[model samples]
Target: MDTPSAAPHRMAPSGGCPHADNARLLARGAVVPVVLPGEIEGMAVVGHEALKEFLAHPDVAKNARHFTALREGRISEGWPLLTFATVQGMTTADGEDHRRLRSLVSRAFTARRVEELRPRIEELTVSLLDDLARAAASDGGVADLRHHFALPLPLGVICELLGVEDRHRDRLHRLSGHVVATDIGPQQVIAANRELVAVLGEIAQARAEHPGDDLTSALIAARDEEGDRLSQQELIGTLVLMIIAGHETTLNLITNAVRALCDHRDQLELVRSGHATWGDVVEETLRWDAPVSYFPFRYPVRDLTLGGTVVPKGTPVLAGYSAAGRDRAVHGSDADRFDVTRPRRGGAVRSLSLGHGAHYCLGAPLARLEAGIALEGLFTRFPDLELALPEGEPPRHASFVGNSVLTLPVRL
Candidate 1:
């Protein structure tokens, strides 16, 4: 598809409206499907009905063979795939096991706990932005936001939490990106997993030797408990998850917030004026353009009809969690537009970005806290901040699992 010397890439053909794509795939009443045309071949499901079948279908299991010989062709990269073997061994373990594993760290992400961390998060955000401002001023008033702030906040937070040294943060970034992004192939995932696992093993081993006030130490305590707690392997997996989830996901959150604020200067100024709160910005950013464009583990457990079309069992049904945020039935005509004042209707205690139902993201609270504080602190420190290079198309992440921006080059 390209010249011999050209770099290879994936192409997603788009219709003008993103909301329509999802509504078309699934919905009823005031329905509008937002789906990419021709992306999935031989699929009769289109628009509202399709979307309903996906989210509410019991038969549509998240579990599927990585390699499926579908009439549409081979469908690899399903739940429990080899790439995630390192993160979730029994990826299909949907019920008790999943809950138990998630519970080990879930307590830390409760509203009270996350709210307690807000002050610290705000301080960290301010510090990072101050550093960014200095760098921008020194570099002729231009700094890459990703390099200066987006990457470091989560990196430092997780590193401090996990007991990983600052010396090897670079390696973590490379490994994290390789596994999360499709730009790298299977071999890269294996190597990164092995290396990261080895590092976690070492750190975990040390925590058992010399405990500290950190997540690794906490995990060590959990593992050493006489009763049924975390195993050594779970320790490794959670550490990897924490580092990857903390950094990769939050990186996108920060970038997406920056992108949204820049695109809507009026909203940014209003937030700056205290007309809206940090929670509003965080909520709007998560909705306007989710850091995760797709849900990784959602599956069809049985035959289901979204809109009206029947999606057969074993069909790899992926929900656009990112897309679902902006539906008319859910959000109305202003769904496509980023409006911070929009009532918090969907988050009935659980934000859609974190997801819904049994397998909700455990890190939601911490993530929201981090983003809210990060945005507020950064803006407070640099009121005149604007993108260093605002023109042209912004960089997007090339990965199936994450909705991330590769780089956010900006001027403070």
Candidate 2:
């Protein structure tokens, strides 16, 4: 039970590699003190057991109501990470509130419903592959798989599912960059949130006028057995969360899988030779390199000691998913190695990449579905795809929360 007597490390706001950062943090302690982008002090749970225990602990909560700093006005609305705390969605709700908010949209993400979207996912995958083929035929014989295939396939599916008009897609994408970003200032964060809210609010209004056979409209008209409906703010927040989670995570998942397979040709061959399935590849990629590195704003409802550090009640804690995924204590000394043949008894991945327990990502099934299909279709179409970086490796996305490269340029 070591306590922090030293100054906390300031986590990189951008341009920091998750693996390197996690390794450094884990070396310090399972629970290490850190400073967020806005110089906000917090603790990061990087140990697998500690993180899982804390994440599922009865006293741990996701709602901002338990955040002492915010309640005391030590943190303000203009903070870049304030959206995570103040958002009125499942991501920021707890207890009955969380259940109610999650329940309203749970059916849309159930395995059965997600599986039903397979055809559409497959169709989108093929179409994107075709687009990639066209781009590969151009000068340099290179294509940015991130922008072309990895991004659009899931974005298209999520946009259509939410009844978001194509006109809003580009703007939503740009705004979402601001949302996930930790590098921006207060004013930029405020502007991004306002515009995002307005755009989703417009979609909600349009759906109200002309109901469609989409999730957005379904949510607008949905009610539980108790007849509870999503309030206006919850509606917009839900839309923002769904749009970001639906596409952003899956896109990164697909891109990371490709990069991993390319870097480890042996693993790629195993998949090609039928020694492992695309499903195996997807799970391994998630464990080896998670899509989301750090998710914020989980507060302890009561004082709790995790990995030797006593986190006071109402202190914000970040669930270090990327760190936990490759935790050598849980996954063994070979945890850092990418092995597609990693065992999955009962098809369960022993990693916290999709989270755990109560707040496990509702979109997990859909994200896996999209990644598996996208990877299979991508490699099947261009088996010879290789990294086309003239400079050793492509730069990563400028966000601590997102764990992916900026561009996955590949020679087709």
Candidate 3:
């Protein structure tokens, strides 16, 4: 009978290592107490089976309205994670609302639509790799691969997909960064949320005034059978969700995959020798180091016991995707080992990185497509690429939710 102490673990809002933190938490039990941003007490579902149960359980809901603390005036409106929880988009919605919201964007991400973007994705990959070569040539044979390559490929793709203008891209990226970063000050978090809403609102308004062949335009013009359409707040919220989630996750995926291959040269050899495919590399990296480490605030509809812990009704439960990825119970004793040749049973990759059930990531197919193209293009162009970090491992991104390095310097 694993039982955690009554006192909650003080999860750092930023700076501390996630791998170590998650390991210590998981060692205690599947479900453990945690202190979130704004001093809000919650439970972290960290074990393999426990997390799956949490995700699939109908009683564990995504709507923030169900959160007892927030509803009862205990939580602050400016809490760092409030934007994630209180958004009116599909991610925080449940049942009919989620289905309706998801359906609008689902069309743009259909198999045919994503396939149509392959040529463009390949073109962007080639262009970015060329730029990386030029940068390395001029900068003593080294360049920050993350900035020059990984960041821009998906960023450019997503910006084009949503019809974001050139002028808005930089500010949009910066504001989105602050929203996901747990390390920022409370005031900064509030300001970021406010500014993000303003910027997205502006874009949504522009799309309404003048339509284009883009998602924003389509969303603006969409209406269901009963003439139901997204409200102003919902439109902006959904755009915020799409814009941030679109590039950020894929950016980290590409960077993490490269870092993993660099660390495990043997795995690279497997790909080089045709023993493993780029798809294999992408799938393995997602399982080993998911881009999103911890997703916030899933509320329980009623009191329930999970992983031996009694969680009261309306308590916030975080989905511990990173910890669950490395669970030895699911992946066997060598779960930590990075192996590209590992057999994925029946061709389905076992990973909760993209999520599960109704709220599973809608951009998954596109993300996978972008990552596979980027990795193959990069390695083929620069097979001898190596990490150029002189001061040990590169600094990790200071966000509990985002798992990635701040910079990935490499020699071409």
Candidate 4:
């Protein structure tokens, strides 16, 4: 294998999205590979095969190891993410521990299971829009949809799934954001994680004593069938993971979908026309301006070559799915534009934001439905709405995992 000798490239001047910088790298055919920081440590992964190699390697662990390597001056942190709850379970390593853990909760994500929740999702979407419409009417005919609807629908659904007290919904919502905030110091994330864990510990304890039909209850019930289905710690960790993952991914999807609709009026019109349809809106929203812009971090297990460069073992790598989605070699010019009617199986829609290989997001289907319902109702309910903020002034949050607009002011 060719050991790469060239210096790594700094991650594109991180704009709201990394697309422009990624376009520049794609033009050169080979991206600036991830190397040590003075070397380019994490987030600068080389060409595409590096993505496959890093994901599929047997020795590559998906926790903070990849990050530690980058901190140690290893470029290519090979995709190690800091707030990985799935990896804390089995989405990361091999062996019975991983297999046993993942199996306990996999059933709830089955295609049928997600389908079962569809009616409730539609009801929830409509209910939120009703509130948004009322807000618009009361507030000089405008409202910030992000605050009123985009954030709540998903948070509500996740609360239902986790069996969290509906009253705790707002608290969990605030806590999840603080836990994942990009502006905060490490201490903040630590405090958020600890507080969330403590809160979940209580919930799990309560569920253990008094189970219900939710995922938490289901896990407790599974104990009889699998015997060692979960420990108290495992239950708390998984709940926290599900809650945060549920909040993080779905909240961003709703926010980004609204932002995309405001950006692309024709697509907006198509959805308004109905021939374009809601499915079109959701897929378009996801592929157009992905909410989760990057993949969870990954670790390189062995010395490897990607796009002809050597990536040493144990380094962390940030695969920019947001960048990958618009790759010139892969998506062509259309990749830059949003096309809802496009087939879902091919092209840029297949971009790796929900990730690929072993760690593909388990909650993806539910998230899609939630966003589709939310956006479909949004335009159908308020086709007359107009943006209150100028296009240049749309708000944004700086996050390593999710980049989202903070508020989308609009008038109906």
Q: How far is candidate 4 from the true structure (C-alpha RMSD, Å)?
A: 4.1
Query: What TM-score does prediction 3 earn?
Result: 0.96
Of candidate 4, the 10-residue stretch with the lowest lDDT total is 73-82
Clash tally, candidates in order = 42, 0, 0, 23
Give me the displacement of residue 12 in model 1, in angstroms. 4.7
In Å, residue 286's CA in model 4 sits off its true spot by: 2.1
Task: Quote model 2's TM-score.
Answer: 0.96
Give the per-residue lDDT of model 2 (tens digit) for 89-169. Answer: 999988898998899889888889999999999998998898998888885689899998998988999999899999998
lDDT tens per residue, model 3, 1-412: 2455456887687744477777777788888888887788888888888888888888888998899999999977567788888988998999988888899899989999999999999999999999999999999999999999998888899889999887998798899889888878878888899889989888888877888999988888873223476766677888999999999999999999999999899999999999999999998888888898888879899998888888889898888888888887787677788887775555443888888888889999999999999999999999999999896778887788889998999999
Worst 10 residues of 1 by lDDT: 29-38
TM-score of each: 0.80, 0.96, 0.96, 0.85
For 164-243, candidate 1 gives per-residue lDDT tens digits of 87877888888777666544544555676688788778777877898987777876787787436777776777777777
Q: Higher lDDT: candidate 1 or 3?
A: 3
lDDT by residue (78-114, candidate 4, tens digit) is 2223455232555443556656777777788889999
Q: Please identify model 3 stretches exceeding 4 Å from their true place.
A: 1-6, 223-227, 345-349
- Looking at model 4, residue 105 earns an lDDT score of 73
Q: Which candidate is the best by lDDT?
A: 2
